[model samples]
Structures are given as C-alpha cells and as structure tokens.
Target: MLKRLLPVSLLVSLTALGLAQPGGLTQTLLPYTLQLNPEQFEQQGLALAQEAAQLAQFDQIELALPRAQLAVQLAPQSAKVWSLLGSLYLQKNDLDQGITALQKARLLDPKSASVLFALGSAYFQKAKYTQAVDYLQAGLKLKPNIPGALFDLGNAYYMQKRFQEAIAQYEKAIKQDANFWPAINNIGLIHYEQGEIDAAIRQWRTAISLDAKAAEPQLALAVALYTKGDREQGLALGEAALKLDSRYADLKFLKENLWGERLLKDTKRFIATPRIQASLVRTPQPLLPRTAP
Candidate 1:
C-alpha cells in the first residue's frame, strides 16, 4: 500500500526538531545555502589549506592552489591561507599576484614571520633588493633561527653588493644549521668575487663535503680549479657536475641563481670545454625552475 505523504507542517516540525530547513529561521539550514558559522567556515577552510599544503609538498602546486584560493574566500581573515596562496603563486612565477596576496596576509597577521620572509623572497624575485632586505630583516628579528630565510637574506644583500652583510647572514644561517651547505656555497661565491680564490675554494670544498651532490658548489669549485691551472681536475669535475645537473651549463640559469660576473666568466669557459659539452648532450633530465639561490 502507498503511504500518505507528510505535510509541509510535519516537515517544518521535523526541521524545527533539527533536520533541515523548509521555510523558517536562519538555523533552519537550506539545501544549497546551508549557513555555516564563522567557526565552521574557519574549520573547513583550514582543512582545505592543510590539503593544499600537502599537495604542495608533493610539488603539485597546480592542484593545490585552487583549494587554497577557495580556503581564503571561506577564511578571509586567515593569514595562513593567504600566505599559502601567495607562495603557490610565487612558485608559478606570478610575482605580482604573489606580492598582492602576501601583502594581504601580512595585513591580516602582522607578526607572522613566515609571511614576512615569503614577501621578502617575492620582492627578491622582482629584483627589489632594498625592500627584500627590509622585510627579510624584519622576519629575522622575529624568527632568527630559520636557516633558509637567513640564506635568502644573504642573497638579498649579495644582490645589493653588500658582501660583508651577506656573509654575516650566511654565517648566522650556518650557525643555526651546520649542514646548511647552500649558505656555505654562497659564501664561496662572495670570497671568489673578492679575489680570495683560495678562501673560495675552501668554502666550496666544505660545502661539497656537506652535500656531495650539490651541483652549484661542484661547478663553482670546478671553475675555480680550472682557472687556477688544475685543468685536468677542473675539466673532470665540471663534466661530473654537468652530468649531475646540466642546467649549470646555461649561463643565464647560473646568473639567475646569483652567480656573479667573475664566476660566470670562468664557468663560461668551463662549460665550453669539449668534455662538459658532451656531458650536457648526454644529460636527459629537463631543467627545473630554481628561482631562489
């Protein structure tokens, strides 16, 4: 037998007793317009933000970014959501959008050191060293032990040709994390530019010891050795470094990574060698974007 349908009154009573909306109060939640409170929105937003972060860790920024964008709309006051969106945009090389989103994040959470540092990095990408320095220094004041941020600050100073300050920041980064080899490697860059070839060699050696596979220090050290008349050793090392990462053969890539004029000249000669040229031809790996030094 067909059962009789419930009346609107009965449905309304059911909704009033905590089912769903028929046609009543705000708490009587509608189908598509289900009203979630501020806390509910924040909770959902943070969940999406966390998923985005996990995806980003897997180098899936394209998939992560849309979720983060929606999270920001839900949690407009969340510094973390805005910051994540900004960072993903930075990864995509959308610098203007990155800066704008980061600025919004900074406004939401004035004391967030990560947002400050990310903003600094965005400015660095835009070649605004002075602003980068300002924001990086501010972030460092709040969180002094972050080795990557310190390294970035060092790069900022290096870009401005403030060599000593750059080294100071790199040293601080090394102090915070002894195995932070990029800082050591960049210190080598400074020494090399200052005409202290031997000092540069030692720093690069130490950097290599810390991370044997780091191509930048390997190539830099190779250039140094080749320039210093250790032709055979330089050629061999340069070949090996090129095999490890052939993008170093591209002078423009090296320049973007903050390799200075002197080192670039030596690297040009080193890369033009027959052996390194052959290694470049053999390397099948595509170059990935490494925007930061």
Candidate 2:
C-alpha cells in the first residue's frame, strides 16, 4: 500500500513579531523588497508554494522542485514554505532530503501541527515507523484534535502491521472529524485483511457515505467481495473503478486478477460497453446486502 501523506494547508498565521512595521521595515528590507509590503511578500511566497504543489500533483517534478525551492528562499523561516518543499521532495522519492526540510520546518515552529505531521509523514515514507509514531504523538499532544496527525499515526501503525493500534488511531481521527473518509477506508482495509468481511464491508460503506467519490473504499469493497466468492458483483465494482479512473494501474491489475480469462479475451468488448461505463457514475442506490439470499 502506498503510504498516505498528510495534506499541507498553506495557511500560515504570521505573528505580529514576524511582520515589519512601515518604519521598521526599511532596515530589515532585502534587495528584493523594494516595492513589496511585508505582508505582500509573505503572500507571494505562499502563492509560489501553492503553485509548486499543484505542479507536483501533475507530475511536473522538475518544475515543482525549483519553484518550491525558490519559495523557501523567499520565506526562509516560513514553516509553510519548508513543509511544501518537504512534500515535493517526498513526492520525488528523496526521503532524506524531505526529512531534512521537515526537520528545519519543525525547528522554526516546534509546536506547529502541520510541521510535526509532515515530519512524521517523511519518517513513515522512509520506513522509520518508530520515529513517525513519536512525531505524530508529539503533534497530537500539541493539537489534540488534529485529524491529519491521527490519520498519519494510524498509517504508521498500519505499516508495522499493528492492526489494533492502527484502528485506534483511525478511530481517533474519525472522532475528531466524522467525515474523514480516508481513515474509514483504511479501517475497512484492515478489517478485510483480518478476514472480517462483514466489518470491512460496513466500514467501506460508511466511507462511501462520507465521500462517494473516494475510489479507495470502492476498490477495497470490491476486493473483499471477490475474495469471499461474490465474483460477479466484485467484477462489476472493479470495472466501475476503472471507469472512474481509467488510468489507475491498480484497478487494471485487479480486473485482470479477478477475471483472468475474461479480461484477456474481451478487453475491447469490455471497454465499449455502456453498463461498464455507467457503473462509474454516482448511483442513487447504496450497496447493501439483500435480505433473502
């Protein structure tokens, strides 16, 4: 499973101490500050970080890395800037560099919930589950109800196969934000792996209720159902997932695995069918078991 990284919100709440008043701004001004207000400069730095993040999402890694580095340069002490740069590095699979950036951000603001979460996530990505747990626990201490911290802490535990601990963290995350679908979906995956099909299905259904567009829950439900001998229904859901995300490599592999001979023989036939395509659309009915088997 690809480790889920916490989303970094770039809303930096700058303290009054960080702001330079009009007269006081002059002495602290850098060469690049000739025409910009202190606030405007900070805002620009944040905007650049956001832009870099969007580019990174599109897999324009080369463009994102340099743009984010420039944003960090523009706001050297900004935790948001360093966090954004750290995320970009993680996306590029440079765990060591990512950890360094996140550590720097944490040093700048030791109690920042976002920075601590990012640090924990970097450690998790590097397979340092113990360090990830520590950072996440510290973050939760500072911001006891932070949903992301709880969610990532659950992820760290899950990676270590500590199912009970992972579920506890995910439950805490859901308690903080009942609409947190990722945690719900993750719980479903854990249940499925433990052979508790009914519980897994329930969690997945709850996740879909919270966020119908989340493909993970749907895919997980499909897998559990197929493994439990509901092959046809499972195949339908798997096909629906592919329709929703035609480029999702995992869905394609799952389809092939579930319907080995059929997938091999009727690839074009399957793709051209309307029923297959319509399955991706949001349906009015909920996926539940029939009363009479």
Candidate 3:
C-alpha cells in the first residue's frame, strides 16, 4: 500500500539529504585513512567568538567590545560578528564606530533587513532624521512589511510636525498588523490635536483594548475627557494614570485644571481699541507695464 511505502520513501530521502551523515559531509567525502585531527585553532576561535556574543547580550560592554574585536580579527568575513560589534558600539554611544561596523556588515550582506534597520536606528539616534528617513525608506521598499521602519518613519515625520504624513504612515503600519499598539496610540494623539475629540477617545479606547497597560493612551484619553467636560470621570482617569506612573508631571497640571485651581492664566490681555479696518493684505505685485515701443 502507498501508506506502507511512504515512511520508507521519506527515510531514503532524508538519508540522501545528509541528515543521516554521521560525521558530516567533510568526513564522508574523505577516506578514514586520510582524515586529520580536528582543527583545534578553529575550534578555539569559534568558542571565543561565541563567548563575546553572550557577553554582549548581557550588556558587558567593556569585555564585549574587546572580545568582539578579537572575533572580527579571527573571522574577517563574518556578517554576524560585525553586526554584534556594531550593536555593542551603539550601546557604548560610539556612533562613528557603530556606523563603521554596521557598514561592514551591510557590505557582507547588502540585503539584510536587520543590518539596514540597525543602521537606520544609529542615524536616528544621531538626529540625522533626513538620513534616517532615506535608509528606513529603502529598507521598507525592500521589505514592505517591516514594522520598525514604518514606526520610525512616522516618528521622523511627527517630529517635523508633518502630522498628516505621520498619520498616513502609522495607518499603513496598523493595516499590516492591527494590534500594533504604538501606532494605535499615535493615531489617537493625532486625532486629539486636530480637535476631533470623540474620534480621539474612540482611538485611545481601541488602543487600550489592544494593550490595557499602555500608559500613554490612557493618560491622553483622560486629558481629552477632562477637556471635553466630564471633569469627575476625567479626574479619576488622570489619578489612575498618575498611580501607574507617579513621575508624570503633566498629569499634576491636568489635576489642577480639573479641580478648578487657577494654575496659570492666559497672559495676552485683549483690549478692544476701535480703529478703521483696513485691508493690509499685500496686493499681488502689479505686473510691470509693457515696455513702450
């Protein structure tokens, strides 16, 4: 029966696929009489490289940097090692060295999304938002579904006060994965700024549903509600936010506003001095008269 022969066929396929090679391909390719001893130097080098990676993951920058440097020297062509060294340099705030190591990794693996993402992050940290945008955009063009690139692009635009563009990018990111909480919260803030109070509340509530412990959305919702006249409920929400993060200074200001304490007054005193209303709007420069013949 076909069922009875299925297991046998799979077993033969696996054997040919090298899964059954006991000593691996090199050993199988060479005769036992000609087999040499294991390369101790290569083994020691790999062991040291692994040790460096482990230390880097644990934040031991002082030891990690030197060990990773040694690993790169031992394995000059290793993309993984270079990437790790770049990350370690980034953690140490050595932007130039971090960029150099990451560039080397990119040279080794030009299409690596992770390396591109890391490089983009380094540029962003250096406040090179324009450069960050270009690199992140390139990475996204290559890998359209990369959420980090989408998020960072939105952040860059938001920092520039290009809210509409930021919203569009965030919306795209959310469409890729609706449960991306940060994008959801960002949308809520954008709506709030545009004076769409109800829509802002809805967006923030949706974000809270997606991530109940997200403090920013919760705080933003509280502020929106208080500003919209539900003082008691808003104050309670603000208090809850403060309990979640006691260091929130803005919440204290909100608390004072909700409780009717005059914290600060509008400083611009308006005086109604009557005057003739004149159209001072600059008239378009008159087209120069045609040159006379």
Candidate 4:
C-alpha cells in the first residue's frame, strides 16, 4: 500500500514545488518559477561549458566559442559560466574580451578567488601591471599560498622595475613550491639586472637543477657564463637550451619574455658571439644595405 501511494505523493510534491513563485518569502525557499527553472538553465550551462572546455583542449575554437557563448546566455547569472567564458577568451588570445568576461564574473561573485586571479592574469598579459597587481593582491588575500599567482605578481612587479618587491614575491612562491623553476629563474634575472653576476649564476643553476628541461634558465646561465669568458661551457649550455626550445634563440622571443633593459642589452651582446650564433638552429637575420634611387 505504501509503495502504491509513493508515486502519487512524489507527483504531488513535485507539483507543489513547481508552484513556487519568483521574488518573495516563498521565492527564498524555492527560487525557480513554475515555468522557467533557473537550476535547469545552470545545469545545462555547466554541461555546455564542459563541452566547450573539451573542444578548446583540442584547439577547436570555432566550435568552442559558440558553445561558450550559448552557456553564458543560458546561465546569465552564473559566475562559473562567466568565468569559463573569460578563460575561453583568454585561450583564444582575445585579451579585451577576456577581461570583459572576467569582470562580469567578478561582479556576479565578488569574493571568488578564481575569478580575481583570472582577472589579474588577463591584466598581466595585457601589460596592465598596475591593475594586475591590484587584482592579484586581492586574490592572494582571499586565498594565499598559490604559487602561480605569487609568480605572476612577482612578474608584474618586475615589469614595473620594483626589484625588491618582485624578489620578495618570487621568494614567497618558491617557499610555497620549491619546484617552481620560473620563480627561481626570475629571481636570477633580478640578480643579473643588479650586476650581481655570481649570485645570478647561482640562482640560474638552482633553477636548472629544479627543471633541467626548462630553456630560459639554461639560456640565461649560458649568457652569463659566456660574458664571464667561459666560452666552451656557455656554448654547450646554449646548444642544450636551443635543443629544449629553438624559439629561445630568437631575440624577439627574449624581448617578449620580460628580460630587463640591461639584461636584454647584455643578451644581445652574448648572442652576437660567433660560437653562440652557430649553436642556434635559427640564425639571426642580417640587415640588407639599401641602394639609393
């Protein structure tokens, strides 16, 4: 008899729940309207967002963008949907759109550490260091001990030439995750900029030890070694670095990697060396002389 009554009771309960109106005391307990269920939209949006992420992983931006956009429309008030859209924009290299989506996500969920960090990272990529600092600091305050955030904060400070502050942040990152080679490598960059050659070399060596496959620290250490007259060892290290990533041999690539003015100048000199030039698979292009008309 109880089993026979179960279906009717369940149906009655669902009907009563569906009658929940929007905006009032009853709305507080059951937020969705009778016709339009907000929870269903959120669930559908989440599924679409997941599909978008999977498509993006395969570099199917054409398909991913439509799904991401649809998710946002479906779950207009969902902070997670907005954040996913923001990340998709970032992945597509649409910095302006990425920032806008992330800002919306922040508005929807002001206390979201993930949203704040995403905003900070997007700003950093945009070269808006001041704004990056503000957002990153806010995120850190909410959830400390994130190594990537600390590293990026250090990078923003480094770009502004706030060496001490940058070093402090990098150190904090290293403390949280000793295997974080980028922070160690960046600390080396600061030392090199300050003309602390031996210290810079030590830091680079440490970074290389932490992540031997990383090209940046290896190339940096090579440049420093060559500058110090250790030609053979430096050339070998440069060759190894180039093997890891041929792009690192490009001057334009180095410039984009946040090498400081002094460091870049020194790197230019180091790259000019015949041995170092020979080690690189992609040789530097020479300027052609112009003929007068």
- Evaluate all candidate structures by whole-model CA lDDT and list the values in order: 0.87, 0.69, 0.63, 0.81
The Cα error of candidate 1 at residue 140, in Å, is 0.9
Give stretches of model 1 more than 4 Å off: 1-34, 287-293
| TM-score of every model versus the real structure | 0.86, 0.63, 0.64, 0.81
**Candidate 1 lDDT over residue span 1-293, tens digit each:** 32334345444533553534655444554432344356755786788899999999999999999878877866789999999999999988899999999999999999999999999999998999999999999998999899999999999999999999999999999999999999999999999999999999999999999999998899999999999999999989888887778778889999988899999998888888887788787888665746445
Per-residue error at 2 for model 4, in Å? 34
Instruction: Note the residue pairs that clash in candidate 1.
Output: none
Q: 171-210, model 2: which lDDT tens digit per residue?
A: 9989989999888877876776676779988998899888
| lDDT (C-alpha) at residue 113 in model 2 | 80
Question: Which ten contiguous residues of candidate 1 have the minimum total lDDT?
Answer: 1-10
Please report the candidate that would top lDDT against the real structure.
1
What C-alpha lDDT, on a 0 to 100 scale, does residue 52 get in candidate 2? 90
lDDT of 4 at 208: 92
| Clashes within 3 Å, all models in order | 0, 0, 0, 0
Backbone clashes in model 2, listed as residue pairs: none
Q: Which scores greater on TM-score, model 2 or model 4?
A: 4
Candidate 3 residue pairs that clash: none
In candidate 2, which residue ranges exceed 4 Å CA deviation? 1-64, 67-80, 246-293
lDDT of 1 at 266: 85
